[model samples]
Target chain A: MSTWNMITFQDSNSLYSDNLISFHDFIMLFIIMIISLTLFFIVDLMLNKFMNLLLLKNHMIEIIWTLIPMFILMMICYPSLKILYFIDEMFNPYFSIKAIGHQWYWSYEYPEFNNYEINCYMNNYMNKNQFRLLETDNRLIIPFKISLRLLVSSVDVIHSWTIQSLGIKVDAVPGRINQLNLFSIRPGLFFGQCSEICGINHSFMPIMLESTSYFNFINWMNNNNN
Target chain B: MVKYTQLGNATTLETPADLKPKTAPYDPRFPNQNQTRYCYTSYLDFHRCKKRHSEEYEACKYFKKVYTAMCPLAWTTNWDEQIENGNFPGDI
Candidate 1:
């Protein structure tokens, strides 16, 4: 994320993040409507001089108010639940990568290729174009346009594997492996960090993923293997 | 190891039919977000399955695959050492 997206969500790189952003906008529309409607009512209460002398309570208004909220809730519930299930749907993965979290670094492994490992530590030295704390020594390279699986675990303490652009966040808990689906729509560099604080250097354990084509990924694998 | 033929000549990659990566199937017994019990139980079940049947038994290999995918290599490596020493906590 650059300075532009620091206050908001980063540029979406997957369908999950796109759906999440739309859902956020959908909820925000209701929030703004509710606030404005309440403001109008408050203004009406303060300025109105007319009073209904014969009316104690109106049944029509009460029913309308109750049913309107129910309708609105149903509208919100449908898409919210749909996106939740959609994100959880794990398609057949083209590649499966395992990520193990340690005290201040994240080590990744390609389980298919004889456990090809890449230990990613924080990169203190950075160029002007790179992010300061978000840079890492190794980037977890993946193939875009193909659905992949990410298995997350912690070696010692609990950590969180997160990438906001893809809307993927899985808790790296010790003694267990949690999996997530990863499908980037485009080729780019996505950055994240260990959201769950394991120790003092938890802030230093950053994650960087470089998305490329499948052909390039295979070449990278061959080169690393050799 | 899985390899692709489109190394340098082709722009697109066609994965072979047998290149699908496999992971542990979901078990309903441990149906929570945390999978610690799932990994531990799978490890115990694999050893127990080995004790009941031969190592080459097809069904015994299923539990081994689950434990291998879900648990860290260090845990299984140490557990193998304990099994050789006959100091493993859980009964086979």
Candidate 2:
């Protein structure tokens, strides 16, 4: 967990989140703030001038103001649309995992490798170094730098499978599977919790993912098979 | 409130003792002593047991009971080293 003074996002672990934070910074600091400050100064100067009544009625000013805003919007829209399409693009993922949200806990299923499944429960007791509510009994492990597809659904009620650092949040709704693409740029531990209000133990259901090297993941798969 | 028996017969409301399992002492080794806590703690123990003892994981009676319904084979064997180092999370 990051302190309140931390203005920026947690160092992005995945490409999706990194792009998202950069786009946000560009829009907020570069585009919107600069335009607003420029407009504020111009409007203040116009208000101080004595003969602004005649100039206010000028048709050229109206057209310029409207067109400038439209142009700015076009600039914002281009990247927004590009990112949207980029996120929606489903390249052939190396493997797929199904995350099923129960009343509280999350059950993960690896359909690609013999349909292996694990029910991740919250760790009520914690060690000195472990996070209080963010730790789980089992950590979902994946290989870094690989595109993976996550299919999310719910068994009891609606729960969102969200990881802030990974920039992935998909609703786990009953009877409907929502697919999301995950591509980690590096290997590290990322934590997230169920973002939906499901029941009494909703806050306890946390997600912990361990992104490891490709070689380590292969070794894990081999060792576990026996 | 409506009161009904197991056979759907109308009857006076009665608290069933079987509904609630008593809490027992907490033991890291055999955390599943209480049936109610067992339902919750078994999930943690199954993963912990297999990770600590991969080859003889099936010999763990509690892990075997949980393996029957809760955990899959490949998932259990992956954490053998983590359990040995006391890095696996949970009370057990």
Best by lDDT: 1
Provide a comma-separated list of chain B TM-scores, one per candidate: 0.73, 0.32
Docking class of 2: incorrect
DockQ of predictions, in order shown? 0.15, 0.01
Q: Candidates' lDDT values, in order?
A: 0.79, 0.66
Q: Model 2 lDDT vs. the true structure?
A: 0.66
For each of the candidates, the C-alpha root-mean-square deviation to the true structure, in angstroms, is: 7.3, 20.4
For model 2, how many clashes? 2
TM-score for all models, in order of appearance: 0.82, 0.65
Q: Supply the DockQ value of model 2.
A: 0.01
Q: Pick the candidate with the highest DockQ.
A: 1
**Per-residue lDDT of model 1, residues A1-226, tens digit only:** 6565377778888878877777777778898999999999999989999888899989999999999999989888877777776676666566567789999899988866666889999888547877889999889999888777677898899999999899889999887778777788889899998999799998999999999987898899999999
Question: Local error of candidate 1 at B30, Å?
Answer: 6.4
